[model samples]
Target: MLDYKVRTYEEAIEVIKEIGFLPLTQLVPNYPSLDSITSKEHWHTGSELDPWLWRAIFPGDGVAAYGKFVKKKSVLISSELLPLTRSTLGSPRSVNERYQDGLMSREAVELYTLISENEGIDTRVLRVQAGMKDKDMKKPFDNGLLELQGFMDIVVSGTKAKTNEAGEKNGWSSTSFETMDYWAEKNKIGKATIKVDKAKMKLKDHFTSFCSPETMKAIYKIFKF
Candidate 1:
């Protein structure tokens, strides 16, 4: 017996691809069909679903995954997709169940997490963004995460300041760079190619390139993986 937690089926698929087993992972080891998870009550059969990608899909399913899997004193919780569950069954049973049945790679899940966190895009909306029609497009890719991860260094480091009614610095920054201008001025960063406020900012050809390493670090830190 075993238990697992995954937010959605797509996430499960993402994890599998991250680990370089997109096709096999999606097949549901032992060949469980899409309907199998939709119908079966127990997903963690203790035979399959033993990958880190599967562990992250629902890393918090302590009760549902752990309770059933950990029958004896020595229970190995690795090779899991999501977090360990202890009490709750899961969120949105119908939706997540379908997702849980699906398999993905941990790297894929992490990349997805980074993109959504960075863009502030909601996970639900991502389903549409990915347009995960076939297993191929839906399968994880290293390029997406690698490019994004590199940007993380600059996205995290940050500085902050505050202002008063007169529009003067009432005090030192109490928060990360008060605004994009503050980021530009302090870091000596040039205008970016894709600034939300100025269409002209795009003139830089590559907005991210213009950003200083510190600025990029700040951006990365905002979104935790």
Candidate 2:
């Protein structure tokens, strides 16, 4: 259990660095969550200290990486552990190669290609660009996004506000996507030569510091490693 509660954006960043990663919400058994650690009063207040706001800001600020890495659930990962996690969870084959091998869906490959080519694109715009704008395409588009994230191929880099032709902002902001390679380069996280087995071991040991045995088992089950 965390001895101190996280009450500020800076504190939350420090926690992620110290713990290696923190789920956006409670996920794995006994895992700490941003919601659980933070003071309740500041949530959804649109304040700088709000954890919800941090989710939309951390990646853009290079403070931490935001993605669906933990059991395919959203989490904030420290820069130090980001590459290791990628190496452990990601496929050794290229996206195209995986698609050719029938390991990935065509929709996922299309999304990956677009995300890698662009600096960063919001999902709302990305859907239209990928011809998934219709309501029926929502599930496939969403699934493809998650598939890329599961492979550590892309990440949530920032959030963008919706705008009208008149240049006025509309509705809530949408999460922006970018290739993991782009995010790593921007953050100065070098791709290392760690083997998959070693990388998994390292991450498991890091989590062992704070997780109970039951939690560790749950992680292994969820991650399938």
| Alpha carbon RMSD to native, model 1 | 23.5
Give candidate 1's total backbone clashes: 55
- What residue runs in model 2 are displaced by over 4 Å at the alpha carbon? none
Once fitted onto the true fold, the runs of candidate 1 whose alpha carbons sit more than 4 angstroms away are 1-118, 140-142, 153-225
Count of steric clashes across candidates, in order: 55, 0
* Candidate lDDT (C-alpha), each: 0.29, 0.84
**How well does model 1 score by local distance difference test?**
0.29
Candidate 2, lDDT over the whole model: 0.84
Best by TM-score: 2
Quote the lDDT for 198 in model 2.
Answer: 87
- For residues 1-225, write the lDDT of model 2, one tens digit per residue: 555588878888788788877788888667788888988898888888778889978898887789886566898878898877778778778999999989889999999988887769888878999999999999999999999988888889988988889989988889899988888898898774588888888888787777788888977775456
